[model samples]
Target: MLQIAVIGAGVFGKNHIRIYRELPGVHLAAVVDPAVTLEDTPVFASVDELLASGIPIDCASVCVPTVAHAQVASQLLRAGIDCLIEKPFAASLAEADQVLALAGQYGRIVQIGHLERFNPAVTATMPILTKPMFFESHRLSVFTPRSLDVDVVLDLMIHDLDIVLTMVNAPVTEVRAVGLPVLSPKVDIANVRLEFATGCVANFTASRVSTERVRKLRYFQPRQYVSLDFARQDLLVIDVADPAAAIAAFTQGAGLQHPSAGLSLRKLPVENGEPLKLEIESFLTSVQTRQEPRVTGQQGRAALELALEINQMIAQHAERAGLL
Candidate 1:
């Protein structure tokens, strides 16, 4: 059995611990968190204590606060432990680079927790991806005290940013953004527009202060429009039947017989599963095979770079409007 240690027994950490216990061929070796105590599992107050205890840990999940990610990950990597780090990889690029460099020095696998990438809807949409030219994404959540240390862009929007970046596969040529604080001192709502080198355009709106929770992405390609609903694990694709038929329908709008004339609509099948479980399983597979993780540290850094850029743009806009 692979021995696993979970650092940070907070919200996300607890879930990782529980999943490790549930999965076979893996042992929940210990937990490192000063504030938490568990009756069944060994719990240490800090990583230093856990490492000194000689628990024979094979891997660990670093779920500590954003600022501590680098320090904690560096310690574990130097100790020869592979790690799966939680999102917003690090507070800044330097810290992210430090963790990545340590992982490289130690020859350890590093996976970033961009959980939505493992969602059934996203997985289903990957195979059907075309050269998408336009994208519309919205991720909204009701006000919660969790992850208040960062703005809505890092806390929420980073998920979509990672997804879109992966799909577009092009350098971002332009970024324009605006954001504001509502329920928190940091930006609680943001809207961003990104233009890519491939002539693709993406618009994103993320909000933590919302009456309802929504997670959706819709993109339009040459002859297809795909919609993915993250919460429901649903994917919808609409394709034009033919170029001539589509043009005819558009030109003869009043004479069209149906609202969806010359369009073919279908829902893609999604194998629904808990994303966190899948993520942990994938991480274990990587550890066992010594393979690169699906969400590599480099990809995480790319997402972080974009999120930080968007935050900077927001700050600039705030300063211009005298909202800072």
Candidate 2:
């Protein structure tokens, strides 16, 4: 069994510990968290203490805050331990570089925790994304003080941004964003529009204040419009000849009489299921065989770079609006 250490016992860190404890082929050596304790597992005040114990740890999961990712990852890498750092890999690109460099020098694997890669809706839709022309996504959640330290763009919209870049294989041509601070000094509500060289446009909106939660994506392709409800793991595909046809068809399919005539309609069946375990299994296999992770440090860096650029745009807009 591979020996592993779980750093941090915060809400998220606890989940990691629980998963690690239940997974076969993994020996939970210890859990490190200065602020919390694990009843059955050995508790160390810090990673340094656990490492000094010479407990033969093979890998570790760094579940600390974003600001502490690089520092914690560096310490673990130097100790000859591979790591899976949580999302928003680092506060800045330069810091991500440092952690990635350490991983290369030490020959350790660094997997990013972009959990959406494991979402069933994304997996089922990946095969149908053939030359997407336009994409729109909205991820809204009620205010939670836990993640107020970061802006909503990074805290929420980054998930969709990563998904969009993964689907579109072209370079970004232009970017526009606007944001405002609703409950925190940081951006709590933001919208980003990305234009790619291939003419693919992705518009995304994220908010921390909402009456209900929504995680949805709509993609426009050549002959079909793909709509996914990530929150419910549902997919809907409508086939049509053009945008006008698609809207008319969608309305007609919903039993609404269309005002326009000569509209073609086709309702494609949707596939719904769960695939979160698939991602965890993939991570385990990658760790066991020393293979690259599906969502590597490089992919995480790319998404983060774009997210930061959009955040910058939001900052500029906020400044112009005299809200900053």
Q: TM-scores for all candidates?
A: 0.96, 0.90
Which prediction has the highest lDDT against the true structure? 1
Count clashing pairs, candidate 1. 0
Q: Say which candidate scores most in TM-score.
A: 1
Per-residue accuracy of model 1 over 1-324 as CA lDDT, tens digit each: 999999998889999999999999999989999999888889999999999998899999999989899999999999999999999999999999999999999999999999999999999999999899999999999998999999999999999999999999999999999999998899999999999999999999999999999999999999899999999999999887676776777787734335546777889999999999999999999999999999999999999999999999999999999986
Q: What lDDT score is found at residue 91 in candidate 1?
A: 96
Which pairs clash inside model 1?
none
Give stretches of model 2 more than 4 Å off. Answer: 241-277
TM-score of 1: 0.96
1-324, model 2: which lDDT tens digit per residue?
Answer: 988888888877877887887778888888889887667788899888998898898888888888988999999999999888888889999999999999999999888888887787788788778999899999999988876667888789988988899999788899999988878988888888999999999999999988889999999988767888888887777665455654666766743235342334433344554343455566677888999998899999998999999988887887898876
The residue pairs in collision within model 2 are none
